[model samples]
Target: MAFIANMLMAVYQTNISDLFEVVDYLLMLKAPSFKSVYKWRLEQEHKLRERIHAESNKTENSHVMTDTEVWDFIQYFQRITEECLSEMPARANFLYELDDSRKIKFRLSNL
Candidate 1:
């Protein structure tokens, strides 16, 4: 049970780390404001850190995980990663559209 729990934590940490990296990449694209993205990224990172800390505490307290529980957690984590991955293209497109709108507004203002 402990081994399974550790494995689940490892899987979660790795996949979530990858997701954050992808988010950072998405934020690098031209956007109207870096402040919002930076704030959001910090919040996400804080939440991730808090979650990891809580999980570590639970593990250290010897909370056992049944095989079914482990399986369920793995499935949940995989789904979350997939959802994040699928949203990346949409986010990129939105950023592009935002940049285009800003350019159009600037041109209109000058005219």
Candidate 2:
């Protein structure tokens, strides 16, 4: 929740008009289930796009994404998440097969 609030703060700092909406969205974000939060996020994304379009048009800077672009983003994000999940066991097994010393060495190698 704090992370989300921080991100939203950055956004609202750029456009004060969005502060109220961000506050309201954060309030609805207190749901106890992932499904509920996902639903709200989708709905809020569309609403935000529309709001941005309307606001941008007033400034002669229309920068709304096409439907295909939105769909592609959604698809790619889900695909990446699924791919990461599918690779999780293989990743875990790689570490599990290593001895303690090698595991520490491998971890430190990344650093």
- TM-scores of all candidate predictions against the true structure: 0.26, 0.29
> Considering only N, C-alpha and C atoms within 3 Å, which residue pairs clash in candidate 2?
none
- Residue lDDT tens for model 1, 36-65: 334444455556556766878544434444
- Badly placed stretches (over 4 Å) of model 1 are 1-31, 58-111
Please give the RMSD to the true structure for each candidate, in Å: 15.4, 18.5
The clash count for each model shown is 0, 0
Q: What's the lDDT for residue 17 in model 1?
A: 70
Cα distance off (Å), candidate 1, residue 106: 16
Off by over 4 Å in 2: 1-44, 53-60, 85-111
Please report, as a residue range, the 10-residue window in candidate 1 with the lowest summed lDDT: 102-111
Q: How far is candidate 2 from the true structure (C-alpha RMSD, Å)?
A: 18.5
Worst 10 residues of 2 by lDDT: 102-111
lDDT per residue (tens digit) for residues 1-111 in model 2: 569657765785678655444553221112223333344456666676778767665523444445555555565345334544354334332322223222322321111
